[model samples]
Target: MTKLAHHLGCFLREHLPHERGASANTCDTYAYAFQLLICFAAKRMHTQPSLLEIDQVDAPLILAFLDHLENVRRCSPRTRNARLAAIKSFFRYLEYHDVSCLDQARRIQSYR
Candidate 1:
């Protein structure tokens, strides 16, 4: 399994801020979405978020995360959509850095 920290760090530190020129609110929202995703993934995988892999964030898992956001966390559809957007953005960033993730990124892009 590929380590998640490096890719996520790069996306958050460089890609979003420098490349995407995301605003402070956008960054915060994306960060919040990821924070929830990582925590949910850790619980589902029975491991720490730091040990998660890119493959673990597949469409099925992301779908479940979105469900959890709405059902368990009581988030609105708009918030759920926003979170998915953040995930999609992150996956798009990953595709340029990791070709192996191309299919995965495409799947995510087609999910919604």
Candidate 2:
């Protein structure tokens, strides 16, 4: 699997639950947010979600995904912010595992 796929699997299966002690409902919500994000990034990049790389999921793509959630999906601001929070959390988890994407993660976190 690609780095994104591997890290994502670990993040959802291991970090979010065992390390962070997140509830099942919270894990499910975060998974759903990533599902949407992966699909959005895949479609935008003209590639399968499994083929996506961590570097491809940078600040610009994340910003576009947030915009898509608001305009195209018609999600409420609350939902949008929740999705953003989930993304930020995942990126925070990713910081230690993938140092190359550290800057990207920070940009996402500082998006406001």
Candidate 3:
């Protein structure tokens, strides 16, 4: 584990106060989504979350993570899509911050 999860957690806890106000369940689900992605990324890199860079996380990895969520985690299709949406929202946050990823985000848009 690294600060990445902490940072994401903080983002949800502090910045997105509206999430709890609006839908705590959705916020919790999104938090799980972030946890799943970052944990998977860290595992793949064999490093901590703080060590994970935008380049190390590409579309393939993200897709693999999603597939794992479905097959391994046994998440429903609706849950998978919601998780994917959370992931896409995360990337959009990265993009907003001018983080140019090595992987094109659009290429990873597949449930299969």
Candidate 4:
């Protein structure tokens, strides 16, 4: 598996559950957020989600994804913000485990 896939698996399976003690509903919501994001990124990049790299999910793509959620998907601002929060949380998780993505994580987190 790619680094993105591996880390994502670990984040959802290990970190969110055991380490962070997130509830099942929260985990489910976060998973759904990523499901949408992975599909969006894959379609935009003309690649399969499994083939996507962590670096490809930059601030620009993230901003575009948020826009897509609000406009094309017709999601409410609350839903859009929730999805963004989920993405930001994932990047925060990456901050310590993947030092190479620290800058990218910060950029995503700082987006307002």
Note the Cα lDDT for every prediction shown: 0.91, 0.92, 0.67, 0.93
Q: Which candidate is the best by lDDT?
A: 4
Residue range with the least summed lDDT across 10 consecutive positions in model 3: 96-105
Q: Estimate each model's TM-score.
A: 0.96, 0.95, 0.71, 0.96
Q: Candidate 4, residues 1-112: lDDT per residue as tens digits? A: 1368889989999999899999999999999999999999999999999989999999999999999999999999999999999899999999999999998999999987
Off by over 4 Å in 3: 1-15, 18-22, 106-112
Candidate with more favorable, higher lDDT: 2 or 3: 2
RMSD per model, one decimal: 0.8, 1.4, 3.9, 1.4
- Clashes found in each candidate (C-alpha, N, C closer than 3 A): 0, 0, 0, 0
- The residue-by-residue lDDT of candidate 1 on 1-112, one tens digit each, is 6688899989998889899899888888899889999999999999989999999888899999999999999999998999999999998898899888999999998867
1 or 2, greater by lDDT: 2
Candidate 2: which stretches are off by over 4 Å?
Answer: none
Ranking by TM-score: 4, 1, 2, 3
Report the CA-based lDDT of candidate 1 relative to the real structure.
Answer: 0.91
Q: What order do candidates take by lDDT, descending?
A: 4, 2, 1, 3
- What is candidate 3's CA lDDT for residue 70? 88
